[model samples]
Target chain A: MKDWEKNIRIVEPYVPGEQPNFPEMIKLNTNENPYPPSPRVQKAKEELSIDILRLYPDPTSNLLVEELANYYGRKKEQVFVGVGSDDVLSVAFLTFLNSKKPILFPDITYSFYSVWADLYRIPYERPAVDENFQINKEDYYKENGGIIFANPNAPTSISVDLEFIEDILEHNQDVIVIVDEAYIDFGGISANSLIDRYENLLVVQTFSKSRSMAGMRIGFAMGNERLIKAMNDVKYSINSYTMNQPSLYLGVEAIKDEDYFRENINKIIFTRENTKNSLEKLGFDVLDSKTNFLFISHSQYKAEDIFAELRENKIFVRHFNLPRISNYLRVTVGTDAEMECFIRSIEEFLLKRA
Target chain B: MKDWEKNIRIVEPYVPGEQPNFPEMIKLNTNENPYPPSPRVQKAKEELSIDILRLYPDPTSNLLVEELANYYGRKKEQVFVGVGSDDVLSVAFLTFLNSKKPILFPDITYSFYSVWADLYRIPYERPAVDENFQINKEDYYKENGGIIFANPNAPTSISVDLEFIEDILEHNQDVIVIVDEAYIDFGGISANSLIDRYENLLVVQTFSKSRSMAGMRIGFAMGNERLIKAMNDVKYSINSYTMNQPSLYLGVEAIKDEDYFRENINKIIFTRENTKNSLEKLGFDVLDSKTNFLFISHSQYKAEDIFAELRENKIFVRHFNLPRISNYLRVTVGTDAEMECFIRSIEEFLLKRA
Candidate 1:
């Protein structure tokens, strides 16, 4: 290596799910919503003047922030928007997780938490989840720099109640507590209600899942004015114009259509329930999921084998090679027809193995 | 202060120019292109399918990156794309400016450089520009963590030739050197040609100026493969999907129309020359500008007074309150009709002052 290379900050990057583009593949690996964005989004795009491409977008993203604040019943100053939930969470980690003490999170929660910790050189500790993939509230009660975890945890598809979250937050008042609600709109309760009560609490959500606008890359966080201001300070220091003009315009439209948002979310939940029942009948132990995905494992077969078979048949799902979760597959609840195909494919593979 | 607020990382953010929205205002503060994006961009927007908004954009931004590589005559492995050049530069600072030594730049260059260093906690040194608003190549010959300066530097609107840049590169062989060429398309030459020879060099540019797409927020960097890979690793660690789908699609169309690109650039240059002559004839000292903007100071008046008077007439121009440049105003060259109005307004202000 060159001498200058010694100074380069090297990091083990977070590996996102493969975005394979086969013509007929069922893409359920990333937990993206199966439904299109609201038709108002289409109309917004149509109305967006091509002439305005010459100017910069509002650095503060007031239009989208006001809409989100109105919808979520928070003051505009209490809300912050970014390129995505990942961007919002990354900024939060940098702004809040800065003490000499190590931050804490569930060992099996969103993997990007640890990656962000490592990238910023913030010391962190991962408290192990119990055998049921549940985050123990007591585990985070100790002294730490900060705390963050997914509410409905990724790759496990299990959610803890608001009372459980409040239990942890009540213990940790001297530090910031971040509850990632990326999957909350599916079925889980959000911690947004507790933000006014707990000045240190920050609740984050995304447009990628329930709103079905992942391609536009919109996400937001709701907290007290002070926390939101500090995050905005860090975001502005990094990149002022993050949310492009089209996203600012179309995101408002996405949030305005409440009926369409409810309809698609219900569709996904309905599919999740039917898929869970079908998998249980085929001898797969499926975790109780409040999110739009199911975590399942077969008693008689290895998940790696099932994952390979599914890929060969153009059915995509997520399988982590991590400890305690290597045997499980996280399948995003797709359209009913897509889930039906996934169930049928898994059944055939199991019968052949038997 | 609350105990939780004690550990929060605080920063003084880079304040961007005002994006005022007035129907009759001549918006010349932000240096955005005074023309629309290529006609092909509109066609591409029309062709985009709203159905695809359900999926996340390609994390690598391969479509845009490949197109940039093809346009710049670099290998696909040697280019990286981000939300904007500010995003590209921030990641570069975090990736390559990690040495214990302080990095170097002109004291009055892009203000965001210092902000990024502060946000990342990297030590830096700013050598003052000479009386001519020129970077002294000898000032950068000493040891440093990194070096970055805008060619045709902002506010000053002066550029250093390739030989001067090559001289700095020769002395700073042990550190990374970044050339920010955000305005190079107007008249100045790019340092992209030296990337193959200087493996430690990173060149950043933006479409927000010449391509008339500030609203889309597209920017890219060209460097050696190892440097590009390291930046990508850091970017992935921050946000895997920085580019939205519409930007990825429309940026490709923006770059494909070389004829339109050249024509608009020539138009801006023509208007800039005319504006410079007009300002100089009015007893204002205008710097030799290779950019779409002019740095001018009146011999008989304060730039602040001129800026305020112009605002009264709904004409916006940028005036920084920083040292050495306080008397100067950075006026973006708008369309011919707008410049005529600006000149006429300035003439009236001067006549009244006399």
Candidate 2:
């Protein structure tokens, strides 16, 4: 290796869920919405002018920010948007978490947090989630530079209550607390309501899950106006045009269709409950998921083996090879028909093995 | 500001040109192409399936990379793509410019470089360009962590030759050298031809100027395999799917329509030469521009006042408020009809002052 290469900041990269491209496969690995995006979003894309591609988009994304602010009953200054939640979190890490003392997060939360901390040379400690995979309020109450974790935490899908979140925020008044609500629309209450109370709280969310626009890459954060200004300082320094023209156009459309948004969110909640019951009937211990996915482990079969068997049967789900979560499979809740096929394949494999 | 806000990193942001939304304005500010994107590109975007919005795009961006490789006669491993040239340069800053010694660049180059250095906390030094607004090769021969400057430099619009670039690369064998070729397609010979000989060279180009896809946001870097791998590591840590699906599909289509790309590029070059002659006839000392824009300063008229007068007449151009170059205006080469309007406005202003 070259000497200059050795000086490059390196980290173990975050691996997203598989994006298999073939047809006829029951794809439920990543937490993507099963329904199509809003009809208004489709119409917006169709009506865009092709000639506008010659000019750069609005760097401020003023229209999208206004729509977001209107939806939440807040002023435009309280909202921040980015290419996606990953981008929002990375910029947050760079801007807000530069203390000498270590930052704090849950040991078993979204895997990208620790990766970012390492990449940016920000020291961080991941306190353990307790026996039930819940973020311990006491674990975060101690002194730290900042605190952040996913609500309805990934791979476990359990969400702590609003009171518990407030308790931690109340104790940590000197530091910033970022609540990642990527899955909050499924069932969990949002910390967005708490932004007015805590000036240090920034609640991050994504349209990739609830709005079915993962391909468009839109996400945002809401907090005190001062905190958003700080984040925008970092964003504008790095890249002026983070969101493109069509993305801004369709993002406003996606936020405007409130009825379509509520109907599909209710549908995902319905399918998630039904799938949890089916996994339990198959002798799998399922977590109490408040998300659009089920985190389950069978009593007898190895999760890795079952993951492979399902793949052989043309189904896909997520299996994290980490220490605590190796035995559990996090399967996204697809449409009712797709999930039925996934359950039938699991039954066939388990019966033949028996 | 709150207590936690004190520790946040801040920097002066880079201000791009105006993107006013009115219909009648003759916009020539941002250096965008004067033509629409290829018809094939419009068709590719139109034919995209809205149903694919439910699934995540390929994080690797294999198809776009493949087409770029084929076009450049390089392997797929030698190319890297990102949202735009700004995003590509920022990732390069994070990946390859981490040495302890101060990086070197021309003082009056693209304004965004210093902003990135400040954002990432990379120590850098800006040696002055010569009196002709040209980069001096000997000035960059001393010890440095890295070297980066735009050929056909921004705001000055003068290009340095390939032999001069080779001289700098010959002197610095240890650190990486980035040759930003944003305006290379206009007239200058590309450093992309020298990548096979110098392992430490990285050339960056964008579709914003020549192919007219600034609104879609596509840019790529060509270099050695190891550098591309390192860039991917940092990119995956920051954001996996920086490029959306439609950009990838349309990027390939833009590459396939080589004839359209050539035709438009030639048209811009022709207009640029014509504009330079006319501005010279009007008593403005226009720089020898090899870009799609002209850098011109009048001997009598103050640029700020002229900028305002043009704005009053529904014409827009860029005038920086920075030191040493405050009297000049960087005007994008628009359609011949638009350029005629811009010339008429300037003549009207100069005659009024006379």
Candidate 3:
């Protein structure tokens, strides 16, 4: 190795789900929304003049923030925007979690939490979830630098109620608590209602799952003005122009069509319930999912085997090889026809094994 | 103040140039391209399918990286892309400047350099540029953590030759040296030619200025495979999906039309020379600019006064309130008609002062 290479900051990066582009594949990984974005998005794209590409986008993203503020019934100063939910959460970690004490989160939650902690050299500890993959609110009552966890958590698809969140917030009032709501719009209740009550709580959401504009890369956080202002300060010191022009313009249109947004969310919920029933009938123990995905395990087969079989048949699902959850497969709720095809493939695999 | 607020990381953010939206404003404050993007960019936008917005953009941004590699005659592994040059440079600072020693740059260069060092807590020393605003290469020969400077540097619009850069690289072989070439397309020679010879050198450029895609937010870096890989690892850990789908697809079309790129660049250079001659005739001293903007000062009027007068006439130019350069103004070269209007406005202002 070269002498200069000694100073390079290196880390094991988080591996995102595979994005294969097979023409006929049924992709149920990454928790992407099955339906397209609202029709107003198409109109917004059409109205965008090509000539506007010469100027810089509004550094503050005021238009999108105002629309989001209006839609969520919050003050404009309460909203902050980023490239995606990951970006928003990452910036929040840097800006708020600065104490010497170790921060805390559930061990079986979104994996990116630890990655961000490690990247920033912020000491952290993982408080393991209980046996049912539920976040124990009492686990966070201890002193720490900060706290963060995903509600309707990734890979588990289980959500805690508003009362459960308020219980934890009641105990941890001295530190900032981040509730990542990437899956909230599917079925989970948002902590946005409590933003007015708790100045230390920051609730984050994204356009990837429910709004169906992940390709445009938009996410935001809602909190009290002071917390939002601090995050904006760090963000501007890093990169003032995070959201591009098309995203700012089209994201407003995505929020304007409230009926279309509701229609798509309802469709995904309906499909998720039906898929859970089919998998349960097939002898799989499916978790009670409030998000648009199902986590299931079979009594007689390994999750790695099922995941491999599904991929061989051109179907995709997520499986973590970590301890205690190696037997589980997290499948995103796709279109009804896509889920039907996935069920058929699973049946064939189980029959052949028998 | 709240107890939890003590942990929030706060800093004074970098203030970007004004992006005023008046109907008839002559906007020469930010150095954006005066022409629209390539015609092919319009075709690409028209051909894009809105349905693709439902999924996440390719996290690696492979399509744009490959196109940049092909255009620059480098391997794909030697290239990196980000939301814009600011994002790319910010990540580079985090990845490469990790040692205990202080990094080096010019005091009067791009103001964001110091802001980034402060944000990341990296120790840095700014060897002041000489009275002529030229970097003294010998100042960089000492020990340092890393080095970075803008060639055809910001606000001064001056560039050092290729041999001068080669000399600095020879002296700083023990640490990473970054050549920020944001204004290289206007006139300066790029250090990209020296990448094959120096493995420790990283060159960053942006599409916002010359390709007319500031609204789309595209920027990239070229270096040896090792340096590029280190930057990518840090970027992936931060935000895997930095570049959006529309930017990746349309950026390729921007590179394919070399004729339009060169035509616009030549026009800007032509307008810059004529504007310089006109300003000199008005008894204003203009620096020899090798960028899309000109650095100038008037013996009879303060820069703040000129900036205020221009704003009153709806012609915006940039004035920085700092030591040594407080009397200088940075005016971006605009279209022929726009520059004529600007010249007339300045002439009238001078007559009034006389």
Candidate 4:
């Protein structure tokens, strides 16, 4: 109503999962890693100097890119560093989508996709997934501005295979297909391997899950040099020093400590197995989860009622209030002890409802 | 060039100020705090556990806003935080400027202003500063969308009075006027005082200067509730978690340590005075500095020539190849030993030239 002209305010802003740091609550709302980032992260912190805080971070994030390239068996130009995975994805929308072509993404995946598309004033379409919630590769052969989806898709842990993604890229040469591998370290094979073969494919991954550096806010993408270069062009126009100096050192250190990454992810997978079995035995319909979280609902009790009941017992779980997912509660897997407490609390809540 | 979009190619991006971390050859090129940040920044670093790194940063940045509001005596809604001043400025352009209104700034101020204006396709008029590089307040009374400039303007350290700023705001009721106080703590009064009276004034400041947390990347803006709310809407639609966690804690700690801030600013002012005196005695025309830097040049030596000569002797000072500023070198006031070395090196270079 005032004189200022912002973008078409059609975007329903992405609300992050609640972070209730309540005293002595068994919390599992967001899919944060159950363990610390590598012990190397602490070493990096110890070596950080007040004096070094005067210098800007390397814009290229050269050292982290070097490490990531080695891990993926690709050149440094194939990788682009951003403040977070969400930051990387936003840049991808601008780099890949244009007014000439419409963006294509899953109808039931990350809500942030629509928000970004709207913000850029780019037209977008949502191609539906199969009944099993898996990406149908055949539906994406037409001309598109870009295609993006979360692997082991959010609120529905259905992952698309790297082989299928490559097949899509093979048929659709003109459009960029972004394979978001945010939860890839848990189970799904990353399209990072196919990045050398497919110029149109960009694999976006995060340290938030496997390396456990979410609060530090660093994310990276791997693609062919041309695609990565295009993203860089957009990024340079925005905040150039996106990653601050302390986070730069921490990110490099996190990547270097592969043993810690493996150990922590293995622990989460093991815990997910245990939690999944317990939920199924409790007469809950839990989908097979390859992520650090599970999508599930009870047949008798409504998901909303169960969520409210769990909160009464000082336990938290994520329930999206949308037409597609209002009946399900997506529960993040925490530490072994935290999971056990969460399971017990849920059992009590559901049993009382029954 | 390949398929779509425009003006992205052939963009001569503005190079950020030098980071220069390799043993820093007298390190006066960029305007970083010569001294380290508050010791409490280190304390905050120590207090961080790697376990917390797995979680997302609070998107609202509520705690940092509270501390900033308390520091500035403004309501929480009157404050806004960003990754750095650059992030704040970028959002300002996106939020305030439209296709219909003209953005205005000084022609000879921060070079990034034009870069951003071009990036957003926001039409802007750079009202020329006076001959002595002073900001004439009368020049800004024109009808405009938003007015922004670094107070104690960059390159040349001339400050405009806050009284003049209040007058402009009172007259221009519907428009937004941004006062960038990037260097205010060193000398000039912040337009923060005028925020209560002028609903239109948005004063942007950063921790990069007096707080000494540049590498940590935190900045803030103080304005009326409505103006800040519009800016926040833009920020949230953009990057939600604008500040990284450790940087947020570091900025909070740095601001709370007023004694440390005061001491370092005093030392910087002392060094600036001494450097200006030495430059004047050496037959150089030094601008009266209110910042931790000096704008100086000799009548005999071309600024570009001296810049090259100093680099050969492993010293660095910044010289812009822009209009009306080609003859002067912007030298950051460094440590006493660093300044002595710079003087000796410059004298040697001059003697060799003669």
TM-score for each candidate, following the candidate numbering: 0.99, 0.99, 0.99, 0.96
lDDT per residue as tens, model 3, A1-354: 897797899888677768988989999988889889998999888888889988999999999999999999999999999999989999999999999999999999888888889999999999889999988788899999999989988889999999999998999898999999999998899999999999999999999889998899999999999999999999989888888889999999999999999999999999999999999999999999989899999999999999999999999999889988999999999999999999999999999999
What shift in Å separates residue B207 of candidate 3 from its native position after superposition? 0.7
Global Cα RMSD, each model: 0.8, 1.1, 0.8, 2.1
Best by DockQ: 1
Q: Name the candidate, 1 or 4, with the larger TM-score value.
A: 1
Model 2 misplacement above 4 A: none
Can you list each candidate's DockQ?
0.88, 0.78, 0.84, 0.52
Error of 2 at B147 (Å): 0.4
- What is the full ranking by lDDT, best candidate first? 1, 3, 2, 4
Cα lDDT tens digits, model 3, B16-36, are 667899999999999998899
User: Which of candidates 1 and 4 reaches a greater DockQ?
Assistant: 1
Worst 10 residues of 4 chain A by lDDT: A2-11
Q: Which is the better candidate, 2 or 3, if ranked by lDDT?
A: 3
Q: Candidate 1: misplaced stretches above 4 Å?
A: none
Query: Interface root-mean-square deviation for each candidate?
Result: 0.8, 1.2, 0.9, 2.7
**Which digits, one per residue and each the tens of the lDDT, describe model 2 over residues B1-354?**
667776687777666667887779999999999899999988987888778876788999999999999999888999999989999999999998888899999989999999999888899999998887878789899999999999889989999999999999999888999999999989998898889998889999998998898998899999989888889989999999888877888889999999999999899989889989999999999999889999999888889999999999999999999888899999999999999999999999988988
Q: Where is the poorest 10-residue window by lDDT in model 3 chain A? A: A9-18
CAPRI verdict (incorrect, acceptable, medium, high) for model 2? medium
